[model samples]
Target chain A: MIDGYFSLYQTRSVNERKFSNFGKTEIGMQKTGFIPAIPDFTLTPRIDQVGAEERASRFTKRSIKKESKVNGLKLVLNMIDLTTLEGKDTEGKVKQLCYKAMHLHDALPGLPTVAAVCVYPTMVRTAKKALLDSGIKVASVATAFPSGQASKEVKIKDTKYAVDNGADEVDMVISRGKFHAGEYNYVYDEIAEIKEACGEARLKVILETSDLITFDKIRRASDIAMYAGADFIKTATGKVQPPSSMPVALIMLEAIRDFYYKTGRMVGMKPAGGISKAKAALHYLVMVKEVLGEAWLNNHWFRFGASSLANDVLMQIMKEKTGVYQCASYFSVD
Target chain B: MEKEIKKSSLSVSENGIEKKISPKRLEVLKTYKIYIGGQFPRTESGRYYVAVNAAGKQLANVCLSSRKDFRDAVVSARNAFAGWSERAAFNRGQILYRMAEMLEGRKIQFTDELMQQDVPKAKAEKEVNLAIDRLIYYAGWCDKYQQVFSAVNPVATSHFNFSVPEPTGVVSIIAPQEDGLLGLISVVAPVIAGGNTCIVLASGSKPLCAVTFAEVINSSDVPGGVVNILTGKVSELSSWFVSHMDVNATIYCEKDSTVQKMMQDKAALNVKRVIFYDKINWNTDEGQSPYLIMDTQEIKTTWHPIEHIAGSGGGY
Candidate 1:
């Protein structure tokens, strides 16, 4: 185990170049990625729970209005990973969802297609086929998905199946039980193995922060995922209570920001679940702007993992266009 | 006398001592807001009109609800439609009766509001009594109106053909210009009693009792959004109330011919049912009927394949 750590550190140092241009940056941290050391996981920085909540709430007060509001709404629509993760989801449902993903609102022209369509592993092939050439990616939740109770071999197989079947992105859940048991190495190695299994597909690691429970645990888990080769750190599985709150999102966004500063590589953030309103989605956008800057504003770096958010943002766009409140009855129910 | 107040403050002697009271000790005036989804939300437009009496005394600041307010109320009504329309007929009757009970309990409050709108003492009392009685009348009809209106069609085939009344999803109404309490109740009772939910624009000039009636609904078992009351100009809101795609029916009780023409034209956009109750005197027998309930209900004719067993034993 010691030899494995040393070899990994040596290869990492040889491959890494100097991380530049962040010397005079704010929130000063001068940690170089090519060090002969990996920081201890137990000593990850503690979060001021009260202060973090207050800061997260402050993001909501920024009044995004008129032209900017309309633009923000469109951005929110564009950034959504239209998701349908149900036990009863069928091929027909996936096809319909993919169609909705492509044509968000055909009545309103010049709208961008959503970032992606996220589904369970079994539906990846159908989603990929339906979404072909539409510029919308097909993301599959693997590694036993919402509950990561399966073995490592089973998880790898799950991810390979989704990838082999043409999923553009792979979303995986971490072993929270293992993490809570202080087996950080096991959690870290599992993520590393899944990242390898993903091959060319981008991997979004679901921390399932609702299960993590505390800010400290969330922050530490975020550090572990980012270090273990996660392409994006997502908030929840959409099946938990209090799924992806602003504070939890804030902590994750902060983690992504810190990771970028330290390694000079950008990772995406998807705050999935419980974010169904265009107004709240815009607030999330505003938080991204303030914390992660304009570079992360695009769908490439930031995405909303939601199903119902697309329609609401469409309604808001139409309200701006027609000068009347749009009804949900008028919109197609997916 | 200094008792003639400015704004809301009054000068009164306390314990026979002439004490100088601060303006902070002013009489609290009620803020009459629009009711949507069972909550008293100020109009999203942030505009209000001064409702004055026949003596030209300013009664209160009533929310001059805009089209957005109407839109929100329609949304609330549509959301409530599924649950309310699916409720058992007897339970709907129970809720309507509960509404009447709450209104009876607040009879004095509504009567005072009617009097404040320049109604004579006897007339205001009568209006309150009539409103309560009308609610009870509708409550009684809630479970029975269907049997009266539904028909077992005589079909030539072996299929059982029947036409039953279902609550049209959402109804928007421009209530009467007079009879603030009674007119609202007369139109609103029959509509809701039929299991439909509605957004009603109360009598513009005398809307105090409508706001108070919303209070009665809030306290009653009557679900929120079943009957949302908005206090505003009918002219300003009637077009929106009818033109809304979500509203199944539009009821206008005003006699303005031009407005009626505009409403009919706009209501044609969605092929919505437009009802004009302008000729009905709510105090008379013409006001209460199962037909009023049928105004906001849709006749669903179902053809089920079964032995023709209908009307074989009924009324035998």
Candidate 2:
């Protein structure tokens, strides 16, 4: 009975793939007649608020259990951008967080290291030195993160400092005030300039979705960032409440999918902050798989920007192995 | 003449035609759900067992809770521990007393549930009353038990040493099977009165009163998750309750030696405090004691060094 249901689901998704291709072609035809030198940011598609929310919620209801759940959890652990962004962040704290990223739980053998350790520009050198030869990347949040209230020159210098300090990736926040004021070109130009300043580092544009209250704005911000040469579109800066909700993530993922169809370029998606549970992490994975398909399932294309999510995932993995619920005291605090 | 006229009116319709009346509507039976985190939820497993009286009549459908339910309850209990253990001892006493007040108001309901489980009318009433009194008993002990148990020691050296009882954190309990209401109350009241949260597995056969008691705890000033109760079989859930590393203690109130051995063996993994009350009769005075509260508490000893007594000889 389960096999039959899966077969039916498989066929329906195949048909959806074809239908989406047809829709993409129609949008392409509509754009060909009046193609301009610069892409029109205002032409970005508006999001269906209720439909996106319903689709996002459906991913959480999929019961991935036992072996499949373990695999999903491991993938989630691997895709984590283990982050520690604070004003008091020091070399010692960065080293400890780097150690945690590498050795999540040495007691459990064969566990995968996280994709990267995220830190501030000043801590990038320390993180790079500590994570040397560990196959872990160091991502730095720049462009006046959490608030893009500084001058563009300062933001460019911040990006340069991180890149020069050996940051493999740069997470930059978009100016929400400008975006909210309908200055799409300004936000686009800022991301493009930051992308250039990043040199060889991958640029992750943080939309700070809490600042953009509506899904339409989130979708437009996603489009502006992607077209402006962001390698990844992130949800928040970890300093905001109501951050990185699944619906916001769904809108972003849908934007990635549509961009992939329109330009055939894949921009990664990162839903950072407020997602700390293993189950919630798995739900995000499920959302990525269904919306963007299997090509974007790896850490290179998807990431979780979080601080405490590593411990929760490790605790769950241990529980699965030992059949005993674990306590937080037994795990490291870093 | 008035009675005849009313009967005719009842048989007649609004249009003045004679109509056949239907029987009275049957009341809808309440679905018994598991209580966790201060909210009642059906078991995530969606499996239930038919609870039957001793006469083989089906009483109600009780949730056949799975290990996941116990895990969730433990999570809730652990989350609630910090706030609950930090409350003033006198405040905890007042909350337990409030639970007693709620239970007293629902005495007849509990009595009916116990009678459904085949207890005699007088015995069921006595059990309900004892359950209420048990809460009050623990309520009075909440503040005083620490004074009775703690010690201030005289040291040979110039040091001050003292030992005080602290809650041992989250406790998991497999309630007694036979004496459902009173036994459950006897075990749970003391644990929470001493400021430790617990996840209790109610009696498998006689689970009605236990779930109803959860309702009582819910309405009382007692915070949510301080006393989560699950209605299920102990045989299936005892290992989970005992082996959870986050549970600071385990209490088993069954005569099954196999389960007792398993509890001890699995509890060794976390070195959890495992207490068995298999032989105690709930009706006897042996059921109530401050020691029961002590079973789920840990003693912390502190020593403060002082200047040598000879150095303070000026005062002498």
Candidate 3:
């Protein structure tokens, strides 16, 4: 009787169902007017039931294998002094590092070169000249690095000059004083104007989520940057201690998911600096995959702005795939 | 034992006035009229029907009410609804309590009328007594229905939100025919309890007791014309009342299932509430409770804060 009554009610209400117009992809189609069916364990099991002895054996072996890989990925690449290079004690350090990368390129050929040789905007010319024909890109931190408390005209001029001088990417920091003062519309417009000045240069909008100190604020900053035409959303300026965490990354990924749904445009995500571990990188990657799906797994959408993360991923993957632990002494520290 | 029974003779008074041998008597007839527009006027039809005693003797010639009376009753109800619905709930409570007081005073009078209408003595007394008590039951609920049904919802932070109880105006109640006096009081009390005025159709075949119940209303401090009682065919009035666009809701308390369904179908014209009293045992003590009145009332939910946001500049 209850079933009959429910069926009657359903028949009467059949015409009332409405549809939502979002993306036209398969995921979008499934999301619109979708009611999830209750899962039955009789149809499928969620996890394999392993015995205590086998689990203990696998856990110990996994721990031992993980330790050796982390120790090897720690490459202490001494940062070149761009500020001291005004005809003062300029010792061809950029040349030395380029040559070292050339020699060590074969051993860790799969590893990424130190996230594009970061340098001062003035030394961008020197780095470009030294690293020319080496497949390495020049990344210049523009908009008066460290503190972005400058006029819009000066910031725009600074960004345009760096980009015109052949910088592949411009990592610009938001004006934290105005941003912290709840002047988000101002911050958004400034970032948009700076990105426009970059013209062909890839724009990385630095939210400094650590300084913002709240997930809600971090999420809002990510949204604001994306709305104002940011090519990529980056976590911080790498100046604050405890620069980035999973919650901050989670918030950023969620914002991207929502923004993409609204605008059908994907914004790349970059977690720069303080991301020194392979496992931490994989964890951030897992968060992205969980929230934004497999489309964000590629290099075009996902970038780790660290000098060391690529080497660590290779070390861990090699150990896991080969069933043998390789020590740190096999590779030279570049 | 035989002594001469002499004829009584009249004695002449010293002031030349004759002593009265026979006592003269006079009868003052009571006038019964329809209370309309705050005045008691006899039916314009100028026709009357007989309300006979149980011994098949004529008691009085009562007015034969017509559809015009029902329409006039509706007009009275619509006029009273505005002022009554806006009255403070506690003030309504006081008025209802006063109504109960007035009904209790006229208890013996109602019982006598019920007896004359052929109701068994105990049952007549019980119906009259319960009618008085039913008023008190509803009177207490004037202020409580709001608390029970209304709520202050925490809407997702965009604005101030609230809801409160309001009346569905001008109900047409078809009082139950079985338990005449109590049923009439039962349906009418709840409709007016929530500040809604009503035009009630008394039991057609047995309207004597119903007409007497109106006397209680007239004597009580009940606002004139808030409740207009009519004694006519249910089929005719139910059709007219149910289809009337001005009537907000209807309550059908008669027992005939066919009439119930017919009234229900006709009631759909304006979607009047056609209640079936057979579904309820009107004799049950709980049946006559104020729940009947409150259940029919629409509770509007009103919500607001008990305090205002307050702060100030001061020396720290």
Candidate 4:
């Protein structure tokens, strides 16, 4: 069943995929009522498990020293989406997270604020009000998040509620049960509807690659989200074990690279969950540079869906400046 | 006549066919690695230095642990503090006694390692025995030091005020540079017996026994990271050991004034408790005192609320 899902990508010739984009924006093509043929869901390019893992490991070996390390650490701090999606989240907790997003180590001058503060739909208004005038965007998770097990009306309403509360970005989860059941059309139409509900807010489609399991399915899901007008593709909701490993992230990055080449639009990538270490974040940046080049290096094109990563990057920067390792007690707890 | 006798030892035949003879055997040397977080790992920097005795013969290739090694050790020590500090005092005594038992079974190895660092045979044996006895001394204090030190204050109020000692969390220690086995034990026992975890840098010139002692510690019931031992230069690691913010105290056993002054200054960074053991000899009874265990303990005082006055006739 999975092999046939990938065979669809094999059926579409590169020339045909590129010829359809003769200077037409993917969104513009949609407005003209010309929907590209749905992926055959019968075939995809098979990912070499060993080769992908080997390539991803090499990205960690490049010595990012002295100047590059400091700069990379700061960039990591800026590209973070400080997330708090707990069931016990309160208005005060969301406000505190927003404050951390803006004042990340004010002791160190000239540090950029994090890109956004991610919260649930109920807390979006509180975050939006707390982070006002800080220039940090507010992102909310919708579509029965972490597990997309809701009806279409409720899911669309969830996205609209967050967007109505001034969420700049809507992070919606793809229905994993349907995707795993090989209901590719159901998943694609659902993402397209969420994209419409998002309106002006950029939509991030979470594939939850931990549940997807294989590199081939992750790649196919990335293709599905991109064609269905997802502004960004995120790996997980920070709610699963073994979330956002390098090999799975590599497959998604390759998919983004291919999609950018075939279609004129560029889709951003976010490998969230389990990315808490400063050194590991730098390695992810190395993977982005190697796989998708420099275009996806900034907050506009890439983001880390993390909360703890901010403190680690701040600590590394402090270690560079002060020549001493930092204790977690010194940093504020989220 | 000498050449004929030497050839006969090999038993070469007159027909030019060599008779069966044993090949000369090669002696294998041990590579002494540092212990961190319960596992024996080579120094992360992959650097090593040759340790030699006073006679100028090489003893072993010891890990030249870098500041990064100290950093890793501090992390392990910090991670282990919670469980080790909260353990029942009697259980901690049992574990320390278990360590002594492990050392007793391996005294010959410890004695040999001490002798390899230039101590005479009789002195080496004596030092090993002293080290084992010191472990027992600390094991007994593990459960009794609080009773001797704790007191109830006579406050003229309804509240009852009392103070007791608690472990001072992770400690960074530089073991004494003399009598390799006994000196390391003297410093380590007191710190851990008080319920604190520590990362110790063994004697630079005499490091063989430190690694062997780590082996003994691994087999004991004492948890990993409770006592991490690193073999490296004191000059390179002293500043990092004292200045780490997470370390609650710093112990320097040597009497070098400049390093002592430096440790005092750097310890101020985190207000770490700095201890000096420069003038003491580990082999004496002074080294086995219960006061050594009190050095790394914090005296916590609490006031209990009472519903009745202490001496009122109708209060009871």
Candidate 5:
């Protein structure tokens, strides 16, 4: 049943190639001394709330079992940005998380390591040194993350400090206060300045959709961030209630799709926080495949920012192999 | 009854048209769903079997639980073990006594269900009374069993060495196939009174009383997942109950030699503690004892270093 749905999207990959070529043309124009005019932020498209929820619900009903389920679970493991963004985070805790990202479960042979390790700015240097030779990247949450209430100058220096300490990617929060106060230009220019301060590192803009509270506003914020040159648009900072829901992610992915069609530029998607189960992760994967095609299936274009999701996917993979339910004590806590 | 019904029918015909009225109204029977993790849910396989009375009349449809149901039950039981085993012994005794009180309140329903399975009315009443009394008996023994079972060793060195009994984690049981109410109570009360959680397979032919008993346990102070009961065939589920790695011990109360051999062979994989109660009669006084509680417990010995006394020099 799941295979049939995936096969329907197989034919759409050809059109995805054309979309990629269009994105490259826009990037080329920017490099050749021809900058595009700023888009009208007020004209962002509105989302159909009920239709998007129904569509997201349909993705969870697919049954991926046996070999397909195993492969899908492994794929989910590889796309995780194992995170620990607590107020009590220590250097020891960061080192332990970095170790877990590289070696998920040693008892189970042939398991894939996670994509990256996400932490606070102070712990980024510790995470970098611990995961030095491994293929995993170090991502740090900065710019007064979880609440973009600091000054613009302070936010830029926060981004620069993390990048200077060997952070591969910086996750920054947008000013929701300004966005709610009818100041879309302030939010856009802030993200653009942070992107420039990142230098060679990639920048992920956190919309914190829970604070936005409406799908239309979430869609508009996604548009502003993408036009401001965000490498990836993340859902939450993992510190709020109702974080990273499926219907909310659907609207953001739709905004990315429409933006790609217009400007020929492809921006990535990251749904962080409150996504801890393997089944829900698979549903998110299904939505991505149907909405964005096969190009966004890898960790480069899509990622899960979670701390507990890696163990759940590992437990499921072990259950498939052993035909028995696993206990939480058998796995590591970190 | 017939004359009163005819009079009421004539009074209804005062209007122009006559209405036909039936004299009997059907009773709605309760659905015998399985309990897991404090919630009553039907089997995930969506299968059920008809439970019939002695006269071949259908009583209710009981959930025919599969191996997956047992697996889920084990998971719940394991999750409940830590909190249950860590509870004070006096509190566990109080909870078990509360179960006895709840069972006493619903004695008539259990008696009727037992009689439906072809048991005589006198015998059914005796079984219900015994089941309630047995719960109280275990409740009294809950706090006192540890004192009687623990020991202090006489060591040559200046150190204190002692051994105490602890719960053996999760236990699995195949309830007696003949006595549905008494056998199930006999096995489960002792296991849980000693702080261990269990998953029981009730008698397949007479499962109505087991479902009603689960309702009694629910209303009592006893926590959920401490004692999960499933109604199904023992031959189909015994292997899973015995071979599960998370199950610390298993109890079989039947006299089937073939199943005994199979249990012994399969239990070797995990080195589980397999116990049999084939000869014990549930109706007799021998059915209730502290030995049943000790069957699902493990002994742990501890040695603590101590300084020599000022004058006695550890002689005492």
Candidate 6:
């Protein structure tokens, strides 16, 4: 064995002349019928140049011209403060939010209507009634308002009721108690049950990112939700101050990407709650744009459930398109 | 694009009714048994563990495999190696090819399991198809890889030397904890492709799918006892695999360095070939291709002399 090894080493040494540049520059000798020792390195030329030379061109001009085109865009309006809307006042507040979304929809007729108007379940019927004929979708939050400490039956009933009341989509919270207790199966089961209850209504399984707290937890939760039949894996309820940060969004998007690759499932995404401005929504969109690509850019696959976000995005679009900073008041309030 | 749409429409039309009813809506309870030594036997202890789906639903009651069960699987793997490893490579390839064909027939069944795991319908279909295609890919490699890795040398010695890749004998694999079906097949197929008999620990909480795979292997002409699978605690079963002096090699898919090192250490007693696949990413091209694993096995070298005789000597 040693002799074979030594002889192989000797043969390699004899062929050292051919191995220069890891055997890349041996074509000339090969034409003379000498079998070349070539390291297999397949190269496909890229469209763009690599290295510092490419950077030099951009760095020479500090103010580099950024070119972008507007594809189809969706309005992401988050309905926060769902806590006060439960029980007796639930229907009233939901109607108010739905009316607000409808008025906003009429005002910004040229822009895409917010994909969904999310709220607590009691308001589901009110939102449905208020947004009737407006083409705006009604999304109801179930499985306990914020804590997600509820029984599977209750969550399912909540989701079913919302769906039954004309909710176009159901946004249900994962059982955080189970999720926190490391009973991921329980959380996944609850989400699956809720998804079953949704029937034709799209199910958005909210991970409530702030509760998850870590990227790995976020990823695992995203997987659990998507695996348990989530049409969309939303970040949080927006009740948490840190609604949906870019990093958290990135984590969820990556999990979705992996799920898609492994399962060939294209899950939608919604960064709800904390996104109070257009820039925040754009940043979340940018993360989605980078992580999920064009497939997740549409309303069907991507949404921002923010209430204040509609006016903000409208103002920004107006500013960019018309070359003037439109005041929040100037942009007619819905 | 139009052709693509047409093909999609055809597929959709075929499974439209089934697709309408998600597997989540159709609950089926499974009763699983231990697939040890190529035989379906109840656990030696007669104990069973309930396996939960991703949704925390009790899908199947899997056998509670014990230390004896582990040993049984190992023994079966060792016993079956003679016939399985000695089978003609072309024949083995044909068996693997047939297994893929069988898997194709069960695509709907596997897709349902994929959906139970919460895989989106579109994605579940694709993953099942990929798993089937992967089996076929490995089947094709069984016969061809021997030529690719084997070597014949022009030595300065009088003997003609040639090396041909052979099985590394009985192997033990710890399947990846996640990725129910794909992960199980990923480890099992490659080990068999190289003519090695394997005893695998099925993915916990998802053993139903693995047992289902065992059914495929059984139907595919894989000799009984060639691929013995134990579904239980890795912590409990891994020690038996690592300490076994009979095992020739072990394939570990875990990310824990401590367990990896421990497996490496225990494998040392018998001078076993310990393959720490810490770098094989299942998401990468290398992970998906069975050829990457087929390359890890050893090629036994043999020597023979080519004689030249004088015509005059032969005539005398």
Best model number under lDDT: 4
Give the Å shift of residue A111 in candidate 5: 1.1
Cα lDDT of candidate 3 equals: 0.64
Query: On residues B8-44, what C-alpha lDDT tens digit does candidate 4 reach at each position?
Result: 4766354555465565667787779999999999999
Better of 2 and 6 by TM-score: 2
- Model 6, B194-272: lDDT tens digits are 8889988888866777888888887888899988888888887776777765678888887888898888777776677
Writing each residue's lDDT as its tens digit, candidate 1 over A44-112 gives 677889888999999999987899999999888889999999999999999999999988888888999
The digit string of per-residue lDDT tens for model 1 on B167-235 reads 887888888989998999999999999888999999999899999899989988878888899998876
Which regions of candidate 4 are displaced past 4 Å? A1-38, B1-28, B311-316
The two-chain DockQ for each candidate, comma-separated, is 0.31, 0.64, 0.00, 0.56, 0.28, 0.00
Chain B TM-score in each of the candidates? 0.90, 0.92, 0.80, 0.92, 0.92, 0.84
User: In model 2 chain B, where is the ten-residue run with the lowest total lDDT?
Assistant: B1-10
Error of 2 at B83 (Å): 0.4
Q: Which of 4 and 5 is the better model by lDDT? A: 4
Task: Report the lDDT of model 6 for residue A68.
Answer: 36
- Model 6 ranges off by over 4 Å: A1-334, B1-28, B308-316
The 10 consecutive residues of candidate 6 chain B with the worst lDDT sum are: B307-316
Docking class of 4: medium
Clashing pairs counted in every model: 0, 0, 9, 10, 1, 9
Give the runs in model 5 whose Cα sits over 4 Å from its true position.
A1-39, B1-19, B257-271, B309-316
**DockQ of candidate 1 (2 decimals):** 0.31
DockQ of 2: 0.64
Alpha-carbon shift of residue B296 in model 3 (angstroms): 3.2
lDDT of 2 by residue, A220-261 (tens): 898878866788999999898876799999989887887776
Per-residue lDDT for A37-149 in model 4, tens only? Answer: 44544355678888899989999999998899999999999899999999999999999898888888877999899999999999999999999898899999999998989
Q: Which candidate is the best by DockQ?
A: 2
lDDT of 6 at B264: 76
Model 1 segments beyond 4 Å from truth? A1-38, B1-29, B307-316
**Local accuracy of candidate 3 as per-residue lDDT tens digits, B88-129:** 878878877887887788788778877777888899888877
Question: Which candidate order results from sorting by TM-score in descending order?
Answer: 4, 2, 5, 1, 6, 3
